[model samples]
Target: MHIWDVTNGARFSTYAIRADEGSGIISLNGGAARHVQVGDLIIVAAFASMSEAEAETFKPNLVYVDGSNTITHTNHSIPTQAA
Candidate 1:
């Protein structure tokens, strides 16, 4: 299990899992976790059930690619809130 304090302007945490051919997709549990938005920079704290090869290829900060794609990395950084 991975623990991340994403309150520092970061957004969602993405995980790439290798599953069955027909079950290769991302799933997000939206109960208390915040949903990631487009052009948001994210920081990865921990990764489980993922290989080193896949982890290296995966970007830390991910921007929304499209309606179909939820995780994508952006050149811009996530904005910080004022105290």
Candidate 2:
């Protein structure tokens, strides 16, 4: 998973999601956590690769989430809010 802090414009590629959900909590154990905090809106994206040009042009699946990190929406296209 790719973890990005939208609030601070910081990106991390090695965040470990150590726990499954129940309490709607997100934890980061190392120095990366310093870039984020409570109430920060972030993007957690899962991705795949394609070798074909047509396949490469296609958008990846995205799960738009909120402050609590709960997914609020999903789509094949990147959301306009990202820009």
Cα lDDT listed for each candidate? 0.46, 0.73
Off by over 4 Å in 1: 1-15, 19-24, 28-60, 70-73
lDDT of predicted model 1: 0.46
Clashing residue pairs, backbone N/CA/C < 3 A, model 2: none
In order of appearance, the predictions have TM-scores of: 0.26, 0.60
lDDT of 2 by residue, 9-31 (tens): 98987655667664567776688
How far out, in Å, is residue 12 in model 2?
3.1
lDDT of 2: 0.73
Clashes of each: 3, 0
Off by over 4 Å in 2: 21-23, 53-59, 80-83
Return the clash pairs for model 1, or none. 42-61, 62-72, 63-72
